[model samples]
Target: MHDESEVAVLRYGHRPGRDDRMTTHVGLTARALGADRVIFPDNASQSEETVEDITGRFGGQFAVERTAALDGTISEWEGVIVHLTMYGERIQDVEAEVRRAHRDEPVLVVVGGEKVPFEVYEAADWNVGVTNQPHSEVAGLAVFLDRLFEGRELEQEWPDADRRVLPQASGKRVVDADAFGDGDDPGGTDADGGANDVTE
Candidate 1:
């Protein structure tokens, strides 16, 4: 359902119960941070539902999918593969190259849930680390995507949204996203990698 060349997230792992919220945030981060889609393991149905439900209300073309062959998805990706891991090359050293490559090919971003298999490291075109320090994969992914887009994702406009948040110095206020009838604006979100102050 997607073109071979697009920026997508491959949620490489999931641990039931223990990781439900985390896994769900991974998908949400992928959407809010500029990925076109996220591929989850078939067993992560709850996370998938929550992410999709938010998308339905917030409005965007972000896609959430499931696959049984997570490894095959990596092996068969038609474009560049990026695996985010603390052990890999620092993002500072390679964001330019990855961003340049992304202009020409699809990018599959892999975020690990537990201990990632070694083969995933070998298959990646670039194994990126936001920092050498240990941190949450959600934090790592957010940093990388921000650098990848050079911060353009922050200004993302959500079209066809049910609500639009007004940025304010204080207090919360929301307006219908379709108030303008263009379906091209929305409230900034508190969801995942969204711009801060969703309803100020």
Candidate 2:
């Protein structure tokens, strides 16, 4: 059984890009933030196996839910974390649920590449990047949860806009921040240092 105290992460992302990259990032985020449940509000592009691969490593401590189903029931847990991946989707209903769940309970949102005007995300207690390379993508999500658990409001950068995910480059590209040991462009080093001599 997983501890109920961890943050509840509601993940939203493209299913096509479901790979070790995403799973590793989210797993690390959950571990860092004490997240116990991973809820999928929408079925974007991942399968059950994908979710398993993502959250299965942390002693299998995280629970996975496909969606939110409840009548007049909101915020049954301590907090609600929403992940909005697509550009056109709206968070009005999800926000309503969070508001209803706990007037005092905090609401944290992580937005993906979808282009949403400020007005839509302004109401969130905290906002973070869902598309940021490597583990930083969910770093804000972890911090916000930490604050809420401590009875504090979220304060985030809410970057000017979402960053788009691009196709992998052919050479010396630092595509993942965490893949190379957690730093901005950690030089072309792999987890095992197997591909360190490739030319730019």
Candidate 3:
């Protein structure tokens, strides 16, 4: 089994209002996609408590940190650093090599919200691009993570989750642990024999 904690993300920028939502989504995506943690620089607008709340509600023992020295932190990390950028080498070409080279070490993937510095590229053990076109950072991170895990991330189970969404053909079903049990097949159909909407 692959250790999801071996992979981490560094969100390089976080501007209020503009980047608050995007950055929060970045952290959430990373957590959902099996990343161990996300580090936000001191310039970030989101609070550590908010991230803590997310992890508490979700089901991972994930971590979130705010740092003042982004470069210094990267330099001190005892692992390979991979910077995602459109200007970098194609992901398909470099991803395999990067995985092989750092198979035993942790990986720190950097996603920038603003124009990254030249030094960051130089500091990266591998600079990879999902696509050489303008794209959403959230999408790029998701794709890169999916590729890195070879789709195994999707199969992960949140054993500690207080709530979970049951698979349905149509409509939505959210089950709270407090209101359901293992033998209880809470999934029910509507009058049309299709998935029914369950409201609190």
Best by lDDT: 1
Candidate 3 per-residue lDDT, tens place, 1-200, comes to 24533888999877765777677777877887878888987866464556666566446667888888888878898989999998889999988877675568888999998778888999999888899998889889999888887788888876565555677676756565454556453433221213221110
Please provide, for model 1 over 1-200, each residue's C-alpha lDDT reduced to its tens digit, 9 standing for 90 to 100. Answer: 12325889988888878888888888888899888999998789989998898888788889999999999999999999999999999899999999899888989999998889999999999999888889799899999888888887888878777776666587655566666455443443334344541221
Model 2: per-residue Cα lDDT over 9-39, one tens digit each: 5554434454334533553454335555555
Scored by Cα lDDT, where does model 1 land? Answer: 0.84
Off by over 4 Å in 3: 1-5, 45-50, 178-200
Candidates in descending TM-score order: 1, 3, 2
Worst 10 residues of 2 by lDDT: 156-165
| Backbone clashes in model 2, listed as residue pairs | 6-34, 7-35, 15-45, 74-101, 75-101, 87-114
Candidate 2, which segments miss by more than 4 Å at Cα?
1-6, 13-15, 18-20, 44-48, 54-60, 68-109, 117-119, 127-136, 142-200
Q: Rate the local accuracy (lDDT) of all candidates.
A: 0.84, 0.40, 0.75
Q: Is candidate 1 or candidate 2 better by TM-score?
A: 1
lDDT of 2: 0.40
Work out the TM-score per prediction: 0.87, 0.40, 0.84
- Candidate order, lDDT descending: 1, 3, 2
